[model samples]
Target: MCTAYSSDCPPASSALHGGPAAPPAAVAAPVVSLREVSVVRRGRCILAVESFEAQSGEFVVVVGPNGAGKSTLLGVMNGFVRPAFFRPAFFRPGSGGPGNGRAEVLGCDMRSFGGWRVRKRVALVAQMVDVDARLPISVLETVMVGGYGRLGLWRRPGKALRELALSHLERTGIAHLAHRPFGQCSGGERQRAAIARALTQEPDILLLDEPTSALDWHAQRGILALVADIHAERRHTARPLTTVMVTHDLNALYHGGEGEARRTVPDRVVCMAEGRVTWSGPVADALDAERLTALYGTPIDIIRHGPRPVVLF
Candidate 1:
């Protein structure tokens, strides 16, 4: 299954070696877990037995080919990837013990938690962060929806909510564009607003789908920086917010590890292939050139650039 993206004509490791063993200290309860999970479409399994875990205040990334079920995996975590006709999504919450609710989230069964309840704990900022251009609301109001769960239905967003949303906008460095229509914002600004809206929910888990999706190099880098900054802030002061960032931008590396074997731990990378977790580990030790090439099915090289790794195929 190898392609033209291999680091050397022969890979350092075989294409199928999944990941390293879980360390002994890796016993802390995962904030989210998926076990032997599966999702079917057209009577065929699109995503099967894919699993990974994220603890409180951790950043996790999901990457795979277009149909590798990456999006489906994210949907399962947040309880969305519903079956069109045959199968159903499954998972456990980070706190639930075995057979209790391993496939749940935010202390509620994804199967039963109402929309508002889910909204309170998880906010999903999809790739398409566009608003109705004709709508007269300012950028500030647009991002305020993040507070809907807290403000509750039918209640007005009082001063506190406004401040929170505004603060997020400012933190995202887009406050000056607050009065602009959400539709008028550039790709990066829109994505930030979407993030701000999600933050308004004060969610414990932030699920971002390709925050850098269609942006250019500069835009993608900006969005990644904003996301990293946001997660760092959430870790420091937010309600133990655990962010699940779904992206294919391999440019953003982490502040973990030393030389060759030095890598990020706990905060691991989950590389998906055909709906399965093909690799998971601290970013540092997760993907060498051979692993990277196999994961992408191309002759890809993991080049050390600046403070991070860049992909060249």
Candidate 2:
């Protein structure tokens, strides 16, 4: 089911090829694990997941209708929100065997799971970064903020950290706007800067919340390309970065601009509805039109726009 967006999609690796079968390598301990996780706000249950796990270096995409808890899931990963009763574990880079270390959120146990150090290793880029462009900071300085977790309380960014931030800005294709006030750039530029900030941390896991939301068509395409580039560029590293992105735009799951030359789908997909994980598996099987229509409560048609599956009402 190839489409015009194939270029931007993930390669046809085994992870994208088969149904929901586990990969043959005897799955390593997941970088982040959740069990019986549930979130309640003001006595109203907003999110819940019985069991979830993301392997190191795998790309997972979360999608669902509005208010489906997609963003809440990302918040849970980095300890921004507290859950009712769930064991969330992180498998640190050099940690022992799978499930060897367990630390509560905001408190360091073994391997510093919760604390300032953990924040440095797990980067979360939320859509809120785009809402307030009047932050009164230059793009370069904004990116440097990502390093604050690593810098701790006393250290300034210094020369080396600034250079690293510039490199990431360049990688995300916004180096030219380094000195520009972040409020002055376009939506795309701000989103790129946000990504650059996240990359500055050199995080082990990157959690993105609807990076392409509220942008024009061109900007949306550009942001998705930037994400694919980040994933591809880090594929060969010893410890590749793992990413979990939440998006409501289903088209991003597949389509890309003409002649873009790179297309990649997520290795897995998690679909939510009314605060619970209704489906969790490979993107190929999880993105059925009928299934999504049920998930979104609208008539969704997965049509072929000259070879691609276009999921829309």
Give the alpha carbon lDDT tens digit for every residue of 226-312 in model 2: 787687567656666778999988878774323342334577889988888889887667769889989999998887666456777
lDDT of 1 by residue, 168-271 (tens): 88887888988898777888788878888887777778888887788887777667766666676556552556878767766455432233212232266778
User: Any idea what lDDT model 1 has?
Assistant: 0.66
In order, candidate lDDTs are 0.66, 0.74
Positional deviation of 59 in candidate 1, in angstroms?
A: 1.1
Worst 10 residues of 2 by lDDT: 1-10
- Give per-model TM-scores: 0.77, 0.80
Where does candidate 1 have its weakest 10-residue lDDT segment? 1-10
Model 1 stretches with alpha carbons more than 4 Å out: 1-28, 82-101, 113-116, 129-132, 236-238, 254-266
Candidate with maximal lDDT = 2
Q: In the order shown, what is each candidate's alpha-carbon RMSD?
A: 12.2, 10.0
